[model samples]
Target: MTNRSEAGWNFDNSYAWLPKTFYSSLNPTPVSKPKLIIFNEKLAESLGLNGRNLQSEEGTEIFAGNRLPDGAVPLAQAYAGHQFGHFAMLGDGRAILLGEQITPDGKRVDIQLKGSGRTPYSRGGDGRAALGPMLREYIISESMQALGIPTTRSLAVVTTGEDIIRETLLPGAVLTRTASSHLRVATFQYAANWGTDEDVRTLADYTINRHYPDIEENENRYLSLLEEVIKRQASLIAKWQLVGFIHGVMNTDNMAISGETIDYGPCAFMDTYDPATVFSSIDRQGRYAYGNQPYIGGWNLARFAETLLPLLHEDEKKAIGIAEDALAGYNEQFQSYWLAGMRAKLGLLNEEKEDETLIADLFKMMHAYQADYTNTFRALTFEDYEDTALFGSKEFTQWHEQWQARRGKQEKSNELSHQVMQSSNPAVIPRNHRVEEALKAAVEEGDFSVMEKLLQVLAKPFAHTPDQEEYCELPEPSKTPYRTFCGT
Candidate 1:
């Protein structure tokens, strides 16, 4: 067995120093036959794990939770969340955060193991994961990062060589997930509900120091933290909308306080420009549809603010007023950010008063004609309308003329506007059908070339390439709509 020193794991876990009630220290349930499937060599190097020993059998054992590394402290964090609008206590069910890895850049990041094993928070369910969902997360999260979105990253996936029964028996796998921090809004909710005022205060200080350190010196650091969090979330959700990403589930627990995207379960991008689009098999009511994301962002922030009531003010009524007043700015902040992003996507360098109406009109036409969201923006970027059905409509023709006149008003030439649009809009997305195709090839046939191609293309989302053309094709129309499962 390879010793811990050779693996290059520079762990300095601060979360483990927290009160025992914050998390339960434990070891992963050992797997029988752990084997490496794929390891992220680039990410490993960034985390200072750039050693020759990582891709070997001993490294697979570390990722599979069959062996422990030096200074590794495994634990499952405790918290509560509102799932689908109902309050419930929850925690890490099938995941264990190994420790905080101090990277070469002097940054602390969580190195976690998903599908590690059962913890105290398992709640009657088997703590395991299927190979397909792990790969799906690996692909999608990396795609998000490439698109300049803040997100958790996947480091490796190792097969357990065991069965994980989800609707049926399937192969089990473990994913090594890295993130800035795993602290969620639900963590505050958990602290407020179960711990004392001192606990909430301590957590707030820790959060401010770790994430919003600029505000730590301010007298009203807690309120500043709230506002900063709201701002980051405003920008994050706008980016998601601009790209047509449907998070599918927006529970408070899934909302990362570090301003990075977490929990890629049941998430998918839009194939068609419909505000009512939902892809999660469990979302029967469409509570988390494409259009509802902005509102849900506000709702979740309000919940987070509520958790800060104890720290926001001494009196309850005063605290409620303060939270409401701060929340009042959320919609305006979101609108400003979204409108700015939309302007960039449309290649509008300078904002005009009519820009909002112009953008709305284009969306209306897109929805009316059922235009593909990503392709529509890409079409505008390249002025490519030969085979596009949206361009055939007279309404679109008039809108196109209006857009040209609007473009004519810009100070810069059309070349610069084209550049802006090209940079803002992606040439390819992880199309639903293509993702499924890759997943099936890897999981069922053990053919990884399909996924490799998809990952390579997704790693550079803006630049157009010949291989991107095949992935740009829409999914075949089917009687039943495409659906994604949590696969927990």
Candidate 2:
């Protein structure tokens, strides 16, 4: 066994200092015969971890839950969340946040284990995750980071060498996840619902100091903190929309307080232009559908705002007023972000007042024509087509005329603008149909070729590769509908 000081985890954990109700002190459930499938060396390097050490026999055992790492403090956090618009008490049911690791760069990242085993928050279900979901998270989380989004990165994946029965028998796996912190919007709600007003205030102060330090000295510190988070969420979700990413599950618990995307369950990038697109089997009501994401995000943030009211002002009525004001900024911030993203997608610069109309016109045309979302943007990179020929339809051609007139004002060359737009618009995303195909082959046929190929293509999503043109194709019309599963 390694000594506590040997693993480089020497400091005290602040989250553990909270009330007993805030978390459960538990260690990870040890697995039988653990074997690592993959470890993210790139991410480990970014965290200043010794990559070779992580790949060593002793480190693999620690990450796979077979043994605790030196200086590790494993605990399951407690939180209450509004699941599908209804309040429910929840927490790290299948996860154990190992502890904070301070990188040499001075960044603090939480080391957590998913599919580690049952905890107090397990709630009568198996705490193990299947191999497919584990790998899916590893792929998507790393891709999101490459795209410059704030997200929880996957560090390692290990097979338990055991089976977990979900629908049919499936291979169980564990994921070592890294995040700025495991705090969610639900964290604050849990404290408030438990009648811990002082704790709620303390949490808000902690969060502000950690993430939004500049706002801490403000007169309306809590309210300012709420506004800042709303702005961050607004910008983050807007980026997701611009890239055709569908989170599928946007429950309050899955929404990170630090504005990073977390919990990639049944998530898929859209292949077609449908605002009502939803892939998660559990999302039957379309509550968290593609177009509804921004609205749902605002609703989730409002819940977080309500939890901070007690800390916003001493008077209840005044507090409520302040919270409402902060809530009101969400929509405006979201629209500003959405419009800016749309402009980039259209290769528009120096937004004129009428730029919003031009962007809206493009989406209306796309939705009406049912264009393939990824292909539409990607096709613009085809050098064979003249810039004007990009607008094949008369309706689209009219909008192109207006766009070019606006483009003429830019000092940069048109070639430079086109290059920038190409990078922003991805040539490939983890298409739902293809992801399912890969999952089926891996599970039913024990083939990982499809999975490996898609991962390689997605790693350089914007590059044009003639040899990999098959990756850009949409699903066949005959095999039109593809339903996704939550795999719970």
Candidate 3:
């Protein structure tokens, strides 16, 4: 075991310095046994941590909540969120933030332990996480980062050597998570409900200094914060759509104010293109479906904007007006980002009015043909269009002709255009079926090989490695209409 002092955790926790009412100061419950499963070496290096010490048994104990590192101040953050459009009081039921670490580059990032144990917010339930879900998040979050999407990252996974009761008894595990800050819209919601207006303003100011520091100089910094968050959500959702990714749950608490994809539960990438496709078993109404993500994103932003009304202006009516003006821009902003992203995916360097119609037509054709989303776009990069059979329709044939004509209008050469499309459209994604297989191997067979291989392929999503070509295949018919669980 390495000495605790040698672990080198440079803790500078700003959130802990906030009002005590904002969070509950508590150490993570020590588990009976702790075993290291995997450690993100690159992420460790980025945090200025020595990989050797972190991989040691003593480090596994720290990660598993069995021991606290030097200067660590563990706490569970308090928050309330709207679940399925209904407001509810909620908080960190099973997660603990082990303070923020100041990286070598002067960035402050939160180091948290999920599935650590119960907190004041546990609310009569066992505050523990299952092994499969922890691994699921580990796989998906890394894949999202590799795909160039801003997201919370997993640092390590540690088995707790205990059983947690969900649908059935499952192996317990703790996930070490890293993020700029875990503060969400629900954090503000909690402040508005439990604390005074002054508390809300304090949180807003703190958030600005942490996330949108550039806007701190503005007189209307809170309003500017709202606008910046809106822009990030808009761009983030656009990127999700382009990649056929669906965040099964877009609850207020799950939406990070840092503009990163925070929660990975029930999230899955589409196997076949369908605007109405939904992966979450809990999302029965399709509220967070592929097509509805943009709308839900806008809706979540509206909820966030409402929390900032107190800081927007003194007069309630004036504040409402200011928020409305900012909220109204979401649609236009989302459209702009979505349109530009779609154009890039199609390798259209020069924008024309017809580009929108062309993109819409392509989606309609994809829906009509039940084509695989990622592969369909990837196939366009081929000069000969060899995978025309994948589309299997005269409609796509006609659309291909139109796309060719549009390509001819681009300023760049065909080679450069192909490069642009290839860069935008990934040759691989963390496919739903493949992810399931990997999880099953890890949870059922105790085999990490499959999960490791999948991660390796996802690490280079844009590259079409010959050995990993099987990953590009769409799921078989039996796997269609796959349902994902929240894994809570």
* TM value for model 1: 0.98
Q: Judge candidate 1 at residue 126 and give its lDDT.
A: 93
Q: Per-residue CA lDDT of candidate 3, range 196-289, in tens?
A: 9999999999999999999999989999999999999999998899899999999999999999999889999997789899989999899999
Evaluated against the true structure, the overall lDDT of model 3 is 0.90
Per-residue lDDT, model 1, residue 387, is: 52
Error of 3 at 287 (Å): 1.0
- Top-TM-score structure, candidate number: 1
Error of 1 at 457 (Å): 0.7
**Which consecutive 10 residues in model 3 have the weakest lDDT in total?**
383-392
Question: Which window of ten consecutive residues has the lowest lDDT sum in model 2?
Answer: 381-390
Error of 2 at 246 (Å): 1.0
CA deviation > 4 Å runs, candidate 2:
3-12, 381-392, 445-449, 478-480
TM-score pick, better of 1 and 3: 1
Instruction: Rank by lDDT, highest first.
Output: 1, 3, 2
- Provide C-alpha RMSD values for all models, in order: 1.1, 2.4, 1.4
Model 2 root-mean-square deviation: 2.4
| Number of the candidate with higher lDDT, 1 or 3 | 1
Model 3, runs deviating above 4 Å = 1-3, 383-392
Q: What lDDT does candidate 1 reach at residue 371?
A: 93
Q: Per-candidate TM vs. native?
A: 0.98, 0.94, 0.98
